[model samples]
Target: MRTNIIRDEHVTVSYDVVNGWTVVEVDGDVDLRTSPMIREAVIRLLGEGHRHFVLDLCFVPFMDSMGLGMVVAITKRIREHGGSLRITYTPGPIVRVFEISGLHATYQIYHSPEEATQRTPSPDGLADWPHSPSVKKGS
Candidate 1:
């Protein structure tokens, strides 16, 4: 039942545990000004012993390379710690960024946080999916 919320003009990061997964929902733009904040929050959580993470980016309207790099770094750090990171609820523009950078394939993405937590238990485990496919409009 641990929950933490951090807010600023550029972004808001909130963390909670859901169904044994650590859910981090981010709202607002993620750019150079905000990505550091996200990194700090996530790193702090990692220090606190959180492993499984679902990052919901549905509310993020825009992101730049810095933001992407921060996410990539976080993912690597989590993996190095024997943890997993799933990105959920990505909006179209962000999805495009992920597609362009081939991060969609690098990261396990889902339509919702619940799905991100539940879907991998399926037998296929996303191995059948393509790498960085173009996101369908309205998806």
Candidate 2:
């Protein structure tokens, strides 16, 4: 069941808990105008004690630099709270933006939401392979 759903003029954000991971699905362009709403939704989830996160971005067709910054900020805050966040995106504008900005290597991105959850390493959903601090920082 969906825990929360937020609808704006340009965006739709919803989330569900699947196998200990909170799957946040975004539908709309993530730009300066819409990033705050998405960020707030995620912060609310984090406040609710949902530690594991998978940002499912297949429905998000466009994301500007502000959107990416919001993601980075969210990830940082999640880690500060001892939580973890990952991303899942289809091959499209969002993926292309990440690639072009070199943020793809900065994030553990999956091609599908199933893969995102399947690769979750623990009940708390923290994985060692990617950017987790427990892992070697830049190896």
Tens digit per residue, CA lDDT, model 1, 94-134: 98998898877766778787676653332232332334423
Candidate 1 deviant stretches above 4 angstroms:
119-139
lDDT of every model, 2 decimals: 0.74, 0.77
* Top-TM-score candidate index: 2
- Please name the candidate that would achieve the greatest lDDT relative to the true structure: 2
On residues 1-139, what C-alpha lDDT tens digit does candidate 2 reach at each position?
8754788789999888887788999989999998988888888888889778889898998999999988888887677667777788887788789888877766767777777776454543344423433322112
